[model samples]
Target chain A: MSLQESGPSLAVVGVTGAVGQEFLSVLSDRDFPYRSIKMLASRRSAGKHLTFQGRDYLVEEIAPDSFDGVDIALFSAGGSISKEFGPIAVEKGGIVVDNSSAFRMDEGVPLVIPEVNPEAVAGIRAGSGKGALIANPNCSTIICLMAATPLHRHAKVVRMVVSTYQAASGAGAAAMEELVLQTREVLEGKPPTCNIFKQQYAFNLFSHNAPVMSNGYNEEEMKLVKETRKIWNDKDVKVTATCIRVPVMRAHAESVNLQFEKPLDEEKAKEILKKAPGVVVIDDRAANRFPTPLEVSNKDDVAVGRIRRDVSQDGHTGLDIFVCGDQIRKGAALNAVQIAEMLL
Target chain B: MSLQESGPSLAVVGVTGAVGQEFLSVLSDRDFPYRSIKMLASRRSAGKHLTFQGRDYLVEEIAPDSFDGVDIALFSAGGSISKEFGPIAVEKGGIVVDNSSAFRMDEGVPLVIPEVNPEAVAGIRAGSGKGALIANPNCSTIICLMAATPLHRHAKVVRMVVSTYQAASGAGAAAMEELVLQTREVLEGKPPTCNIFKQQYAFNLFSHNAPVMSNGYNEEEMKLVKETRKIWNDKDVKVTATCIRVPVMRAHAESVNLQFEKPLDEEKAKEILKKAPGVVVIDDRAANRFPTPLEVSNKDDVAVGRIRRDVSQDGHTGLDIFVCGDQIRKGAALNAVQIAEMLL
Candidate 1:
């Protein structure tokens, strides 16, 4: 359990994905403890070699026996694959850190963000050998709650209404390529086709986060609602989201309207956010300084700005803030690796 | 009011702006009957020529005497110019349709949208040139209420929460150029500058729409609240808006959550929207056919989709709908021209 000592070996599943590539890069950049590294993915990706830490390793097709000698496994494959193979990896004595939403809300599993809840990582029971599958919250949820959670400690977070401008990377590598290609086509005087998304992805914006449920809310919207509650541990924290996909390449930007139980001011909000673990506050409106997707795309920390007092509701104090984070970094890979770092 | 019979002439203020150019284009394309067209702008843009209807008209410097021989003047200029010259035009016996927020909520001035409130156009009372100014609603309000006003006829619209993906065109010509330049810089492997917006507009989204008010809401949010009430002729519609600027060019997208006094269904919503003038419902999820920015750009009607029942609250039906319309067209110029058409 000591990261100080040379730590146990690590395995990264789906190492070719946007998030998976970020995981490998973050691990090497952060110099996270590991005696050895293993790359795993589907059969088609097997035998493909990736270079990390000046060493070349071949990817092996993920199977039930893939985690036999591995100490920790990082998962970024699709949800169905994670749902089917996650418990099996756990069964083979590998502690699984899943980036998918498969077991996030399970009664027995622990959803962990090391910065917010490192103690939660210890709840992974040892004897279960279905080694603990630690769930990582969604990208948007992690970026938002990182700023809001610290404020909630001083005052209760009553409700949050978020509108997200998500990047193409969140949809995976091919979709990102589609965005780039479609944009190139549009610039070249051609109409971009709709294949990866319901609408055109070049120079366009639409509501394609997830399919809307029978409740008139899309799956992506519901995830922001449900995951925020799970992360903040407050079901009464009302959350409403209108998630949209924009033509951005990397960072996911969210405009969060939060109503607090107590009054919050600029000084207090800045003071709290500046001290928060993974938050950076950049609120200078006169010079027009605030976080944008390009500024936070490759960074580890969540960039926040436009932090000011809510003038609409007089009696019930509120704070209006904007947050941007690398969906592939803190939103996905860096967070998963951070959770693993906590356990080590 | 007769198209064939001309009194004096017509003038267009702010003729070089995004909405202004669109006004010129729509007028020419629709064969609007203007005996003569006087183009006006600031002293800097004076002496330029705007080609319309197979004729080139020299732009004049905006001043008090600019509307001397003008019978009808359409103002799509900023608030300051509208406030300064709208009355001047009205003083010269011109029926002024101001596309700015200057006279929108004035006590005696009428706010008109031809489709939703044609009665308002007819309701223009006989008065001196002093009270001749007519107000146009905000872009977001015009788009949202166009889709929702029909529903309100069948069910009371109790509350509405909207999240807008506004295009660069809403912020004027500089913003549009900023988006294009910033995007080009990003594609060329350079860090773009942030001037027109608070953040980098290339592949970045920021939530500072209309200035941020003291109460946490931005001017854009408050405008939606105030404009919707005035447009619907209801003082108690209960509107909440979170407006964010995305990296799109012309059309603005809105995700609306509405709660009605009575139960609503997807089929009924679809029917009402289809029959409503200036609205097109493209709600075939199975075929992946929904309204998108590219599809609705340069079009007059508001395109709506993602309609369903709200499963979260019992007896309180919910709907998720998207609206995309060219902010310059239906949101500004065409709407004003359509109001003039109703007057005729």
Candidate 2:
């Protein structure tokens, strides 16, 4: 295929992984304009062939020279790889939108969820003379803030309690495959294969496999607590989360309880969310219909439902909601692509 | 088989149901003394045979006269059946331990968890020649309070927020078989059967199927809210809950956040739960192991783990815990059987 040679050149890091493949899907789905595109991966996958945008491209192993002429780079490799190559790509004059935790909390890097904090990357653009780094928020954090930010803007949230039903996709492709294999093995009356996770992931759920921090909160839960503070630019807003991995495939569901500084009735909150971008309201009290992970598996918008007043809180100062979103779409790849689009 | 004639005459209501069969298992396991036992069910199941304590007995249809000379009766039938037969059993001089929601919130009927509030049934005995009624708490409530009450007793919890991951068994044996069948059908690339629940239950989760009240909380969630206040005899305690149904078979998991009036550190809370009856702590931070539903499938003790100080609250005035217990065993049949043991 011949290149159009009319837009900024792009590079996709970790081109063979789950979120990496999703980046391509989202880019093509949105008809993203690119003059040229480079497929980059680890040394083991360097010679593999991938089809993107009706063009056959050979994957090149990531190296310093890989980003020499790139204008925008989307990185979804693990933290160690991003820690080593994210800066190198930036130093080579490419705007790096990293989908790893390596630079999320760093002061210099802007943690961007385009819908919530697009202004964080204000002066940075593609085809610019200078290089920059923009970090993508964690999958859980992105999905949560998609529904929470609009409400927070209205009543000024004071405290939030979240309980997550996370999917296997958050752990990447291997873990998702393991869940399927384990489910089949369990059904066949054989022992489930227990790779990727230490315990059974077959008809059962467990606390997230993330390393537990010293304070008894797993690293995944701490990401929700810390990233919400950074993304909202409000350190005083209290957040606590309990993250559990269910047997679902590729979407995450959350039960969120919000306490605001001022009164916000459920009706007004629903109106605000219905107008918010990248959010869909599925609250149907009459039909008893609400958001489910399967309903949002491959969709872009986050679905919010179960909108009601928190009876435990005084009057109307509190509201509770249930939200579900595709972990790989809106949570990771689509959000990162949206940030890259703002640069155009 | 001949009657023992050494203890109270017993009657088991709804003997063909899930919890009904479990009631017999728990009775035999504890070697509960019964001079004579009657297996009673609806007319459709009459003449069926049920084996208990190595003796086979014919199931009888429940009627007003079925409770004649019956010292105690355990009821696992639905609310309507219980409402119809409970008063009849009581009028016939039988002490009734009903597992339905028919009389949980009644004025004079005592809702009992043998470990939490045995004294509420004070002066009520099996052979007292007078009949009485007792109600069993909901499964989720029984599992959550089993862990929370110990800490609440020490620090005096003022508010509670709970989110549940409930199993299929809470619906019935038919629902459990449906889950297994739906799982197999889904794996075979066929559509899942959605009979017991309106939504697919193979690898998905949804909000509880309990009817939503005018206040927007479902009956299951409200049960937690109202039962806590009643069980603790504290009208001022505030509680909120979000109940969800997951795909597990016979156990439920709950994530609980509690705010207390007095300061209680995590270490002290652990110490208290360690000594508390019907509670087990499985917190192993280094191993990243916590309470999982599969681990407590048929166990009597409710397992508690992921114990930590709530950083959202200041100075140990709050705590977070995860709990799991068998929905059929400790949550229903075992609990009712324990209440019957108290009568003896």
User: Candidates' interface RMSDs, in order?
Assistant: 3.2, 0.8
Summarize candidate 1's per-residue lDDT along B21-70 as a digit string, tens digits: 98888887777876777899998889998777767789999999888867
Query: Compared with the true structure, what per-residue lDDT tens digits does model 2 show for residues A1-344?
Result: 33467778999999899999999999888888889999999999899999887779999999989998899999998998899989898888899999999999999799999999988999998988589999999999999999999999999998999999999999999999998899899888999988899989887999988999999999999999999999999999998899999999999999998999999999999999999999999988777889999999899999998888998898899988999999999999999999999998
Best by DockQ: 2
* lDDT of each residue in A118-230, candidate 1, tens digit only: 76777563224547788999888888888888888888888776778889988998888888777767767787866887567877877765765656567777888888777
* Backbone clashes in model 2, listed as residue pairs: none
Write one digit per residue (lDDT tens) for candidate 2, span B23-87. 98888888888899999999999999977878889999999899999999999979988999999
How far residue A196's Cα lies from its native spot in candidate 2, in Å, is 0.9
Candidate no. 1 TM-score: 0.90
Evaluate residue B231 in candidate 1 and report its C-alpha lDDT on the 0 to 100 scale.
Answer: 81
Give the docking tier of candidate 1.
acceptable
Show where candidate 2 strays beyond 4 Å.
A1-3, B1-3
